[model samples]
Target: MAGTYSVNTNLIAKLAELRITEKDIHACKLPAYEQSGNLVQAEDDMFGRTQLMTPATLTSWQNLKKAAQDEGITLLLVSAFRSIDYQCELIAAKLERGQKLSDILSVNAIPGFSEHHTGRALDINTPDCEPLSEAFEETPAFTWLEANASRYEFGLSFPRDNEFGISYEPWHWACRLLD
Candidate 1:
């Protein structure tokens, strides 16, 4: 994975701007992900925002969604591909809102380190639940995903006590790249 993605100077500067040090990067348990260059538009999210993902991820997500639907569950996309710049903006917004940097980093990955940059990660939800809340774990959509998402090559990225040190995110899943 190290050889797969090289962090550029701009990203380094951005991390510095966010007050993320080399020690912070080294402490992160998750691997850095390169932003996908080959991405296609996926289905519009519940908010009607267009999402993008790698072609294989899009196909797998569609299959997973269809299978869930067949089982009387509905999966809605909340987020997909996100650029390093977008990641920076998210962190900056949180910082401006007075959130501690450490708290922010625990949830949102530093720019260039987010799995969302890979275009294979998805934040999913079902109707009647908060989009990114831990309560999703109790929903039928999450139960269906836990039992069946692997059939489409998707798996939860961060679970309870995950080594990534990220918070438990029941709504986040990522597709395995066949390539």
Candidate 2:
């Protein structure tokens, strides 16, 4: 489980030669929306539109799903790990669509600043429930997570209106350990 900042010596030297200072290294954690590594037991085992979660994230998500199922709630994955290049492409695409870089970075993380870089985050949804919007934080799943995520070693990286600068992602969850 290599982390986002785990760069090789060769790459380090190359970056140094380019005068890319540490302050310039905008290493974003992988977003909960992008899938990566082996988050799921089966590669294709998606709850809905989301896919490509690491194994650890998938295990925790499954546990949460089972608990929800037992309580008559249906949970689904909406998105999960995007590659660095993919994210760059996304940013480029957004800019092409006329979105300002500053505005985009405010809501969408700048490539490396995303938590998905760590392969520990996930985005979830509920079936027959309204698709997750900014207000999804008020839903039962989000409410359930507020109380129960800690039991599964999962946590909400961004809480409601916290001073973290990053926007709140109610559907996002991350593992406490790689596992």
Q: Model-by-model lDDT, in order?
A: 0.89, 0.62
Question: Looking at model 1, which ten-residue stretch has the lowest summed lDDT?
Answer: 1-10
lDDT of 2 by residue, 35-152 (tens): 3455443233244333566677777777877887787766666666656556667767777888876666666665545676556776766655555466677677777778787888
Query: In model 2, how large is the Cα lDDT of residue 165?
Result: 53
TM-score against truth, every candidate: 0.92, 0.72
Model 1 Cα shift for residue 178 (angstroms): 4.2
Put down candidate 1 lDDT per residue, 1-179, tens digits, no spaces. Answer: 24224667777788899888877877777787788898999989999999999999999999999999999999999999999899999999999999999999877888888889999999999999999999999999999999999999999999999877778999999999743
Best prediction by lDDT: 1
